[model samples]
Target: MPVCPYCQVEMDDDLDTCPNCGITMIYFFKCQRCGQEFATTGILKFCPLCDADLSEQMN
Candidate 1:
């Protein structure tokens, strides 16, 4: 079993969706503000690294 970062819920390593939160299990960094963890390894509007809006950082 693996722990989900979004909700800190436990889930099967091979499974796709989370049994508790219903979020798709994936590799991501959680955003401190919205509590939304996003996928990495690609360009994203937010902190796929943390789900933080990148536009805010651009300032």
Candidate 2:
């Protein structure tokens, strides 16, 4: 799992923004299940690439 360098939370490596700290331009998310990468403007509940339930992983 890729960790948010700022928030220190386990993040989906496919995302370019930290779900906890909202950091961008550096951090990104990669799907733990599908290993797909994507960008985000805000908190997402599911992965657009694989439709993974991202909310459950946040906690």
Candidate 3:
């Protein structure tokens, strides 16, 4: 299972992206506003906290 860095919530590890925050997988990603530690596969673009767009928020 995967853990949401923003909320520390448990999620499915196979998720290519987070359903709640839209974060990727593997790489280190932190909520720009809240400063939470998350892993991203480098394919998302939203903070999920303040709903801000990440570098890759859209597909």
Candidate 4:
């Protein structure tokens, strides 16, 4: 199960939007430098853990 970012409600993984808050589900970002993935609500230009530039990576 995944928690909604807006309401913090637990939801199924197959859903793309939260039922309670109506916010979009998590967006995954892969860090090219460290080969790690991050979950965010929107687009991120840099990795939070590695500080790598992620603008070139495909969403």
Best by TM-score: 4
* Ranking of candidates on lDDT, top first: 4, 2, 3, 1
User: Residue 52 deviation, candidate 3, in Å?
Assistant: 38
Going through the candidates in the order shown, the clash numbers are: 2, 8, 7, 0
What's the TM-score of every candidate structure? Answer: 0.39, 0.43, 0.37, 0.52
Candidate 3 per-residue lDDT over residues 1-59, each given as its tens digit: 76887767677745767788876556656666677666656545777567666665232
| Lowest lDDT 10-residue stretch of candidate 3 | 50-59
* Cα RMSD for candidates in order: 10.0, 7.6, 10.5, 7.5
lDDT of each candidate versus the true structure: 0.60, 0.69, 0.65, 0.79
Give, for candidate 2, the lowest lDDT window spanning 10 residues: 24-33
Candidate 4 lDDT for residue 28: 82
Put the candidates in TM-score order, highest first. 4, 2, 1, 3
Candidate 2, lDDT over the whole model: 0.69
The Cα RMSD in angstroms, rounded to one decimal, for candidate 1 relative to the true structure is 10.0
**lDDT winner, 2 or 3:** 2
For model 1, name the residue pairs that clash.
31-50, 47-51
Tell me, by lDDT, which candidate is best: 4
For residues 1-59, write the lDDT of model 2, one tens digit per residue: 76777778887757767788888734246677798876666557788878887776553
